[model samples]
Target: MKRDQARRAYWSQNLRYLAGLLLVWFAVSFGAGILLVEELDQLRVFGFKLGFWFAQQGAIYAFVVLILVYVVLMNRLDRRYSRDEEDPA
Candidate 1:
């Protein structure tokens, strides 16, 4: 029962992280790139229109960052669960 509970907790945390990251990705890629492109195009970033940059490059950068975030978060989860296995309550 304890093992099952722990497993569920881990997966729940994992899913939560995934959902949050995906939400950010969607906001960046879909929202910024398409939905708000015209408004954002008024702004400039590094001499490039903000909307164009987001549509072409910003979303990709965000995805890479998200991948890094996922790796770090999952590593922390792994370490925490491994420790839990090593020392029981």
Candidate 2:
């Protein structure tokens, strides 16, 4: 593939992954925590309110996981796209 085309493809992949992750983060943090707190509160985990826990701690953990996932994926993408340049004797 052409260099510009390859670069665009890589960027599109990266953006799509990032956007999906952010969407999940938003859904869990805001949607479940604030919008559906009452329903979530009906469920309990070890006596902790599900919605409150998500708002305070779960979202933070999810963000950390997202960072790790991005780092790993970027590393793989970099390796996959790296130029195989070698000197010809």
Best by TM-score: 1
lDDT string for model 1 (1-89, tens) is: 66777788889999999999999999999999999999999999899999999999999999999999999999999998777666667
**Model 2, range 1-89, lDDT digits (tens) per residue?**
36666678778888988898889888888888788888888889987889888887887888889889889998988776565222122
Candidate 2: clashing pairs of residues: none
Which candidate should be chosen as best, given lDDT against the real structure? 1
Which segments of model 2 are wrong by more than 4 Å?
83-89
The global Cα lDDT (0 to 1) of model 2 is: 0.79
Q: What is the C-alpha RMSD of each candidate to the true structure, in Å?
A: 1.1, 3.3
For candidate 2, report its TM-score.
0.83
Per-residue error (Å), model 1, residue 80? 0.7
lDDT of 2 at 23: 92
